[model samples]
Target: MLPWIFIGLALFFGVFWFSGNAANILIIYVIGLTGMGVFLVLTSLTISKQSNLLKKAFETEKNYPPLLVKAILLFAGIGMLFGSIRYWQDVPFYQDQNFSVISGKPSSIDEYNSKGTVTELYVEIKGHTFVLDADMPQFPKYKKYEELLDKHFTILYLPNSNWIIDYKVE
Candidate 1:
């Protein structure tokens, strides 16, 4: 019973740590690793405590159902591991993001993306190739943001990603 309480508290704290940064990939990865660590610790503690209990009480209590606990912990630990793997794959690229301002004409303009209202506009910046979200702050600066197919522009990208931090119509 005590061990199960400890395990529950650990899992709760793990979620509390992640709730604040649910949108942050790196934070999510850290939480996943931490949650798995907590699960392992609780499992070991439960095993040790079970051995120390008197025979009759141990037999009667059957306190924590081993199979049920194992299944729950295994499910949570595996879920966290998968999250960590996804974020881990991006770590190498994130470390070497280019910081220079780049310029080029978009080869294509994607209109009618349904992100918010059935297909918003997007511009594929030639140099970076990632479609910059047309609804971003810089959209108003473009005379007709969606008409970027042939126009040239300078774009600032967020480090290590295709996301445009800002843009200038040249």
Candidate 2:
């Protein structure tokens, strides 16, 4: 009975997290629910209790082990607290942001040999569309735009300090 209750609670929390605005919260909720569900199922099947009590808990009224509830609560509370903290610190999906253009123009064949080890991305944040600089210098190998990222590409510069480029589609 207790296992079922925990499972229901996990499902309820899971739904709320999925509907919320925070992506991190959704991730944590999924992990927490899955972990708790597994724990409850295992406990329901394994706890050595009097057959009569077990029957009463399951056949008549739903009841669960207090220790199990305590453990689940503790784990869930910690996860929720941590996730909330992270959500507060991260940038929301809706934000006005921009990306820096490193390459002056787009090139058919592009080469970025730079001194800075880049981790952050520069984007032109106008409303929702991210106008990637066609010619971004020192672009990251993994995240560069696909269209303007061939061995050879053309570089175009927008008068507004943004660069456009034509590179290999691959």
Model 1: ten consecutive residues of lowest lDDT: 20-29
lDDT of 2 by residue, 35-150 (tens): 44454445445444444455555554333554454456556655555545433333231122232223322333223334654333333222211233223454436544444333
Candidate of highest lDDT: 1
> How would you encode candidate 1's per-residue C-alpha lDDT over 41-105 as one tens digit per residue?
56544654244353354465564655445556666656665655644554554456543477787
Q: In lDDT terms, how accurate is model 2?
A: 0.40
**TM-scores of all predicted structures:** 0.39, 0.28
TM-score of 2: 0.28
- Report the Cα lDDT for residue 73, model 1: 62
- For model 1 the TM-score comes to 0.39
Itemize residue pairs with steric clashes in candidate 1.
Answer: 112-119, 113-119, 113-120, 114-118, 114-119
Model 1 bad stretches (over 4 Å):
1-98, 115-119, 140-146
Deviation in angstroms for 31 in model 1?
9.4
Give Cα-based local distance difference scores for all models: 0.55, 0.40
Residue 117 lDDT, candidate 1, scale 0-100: 53
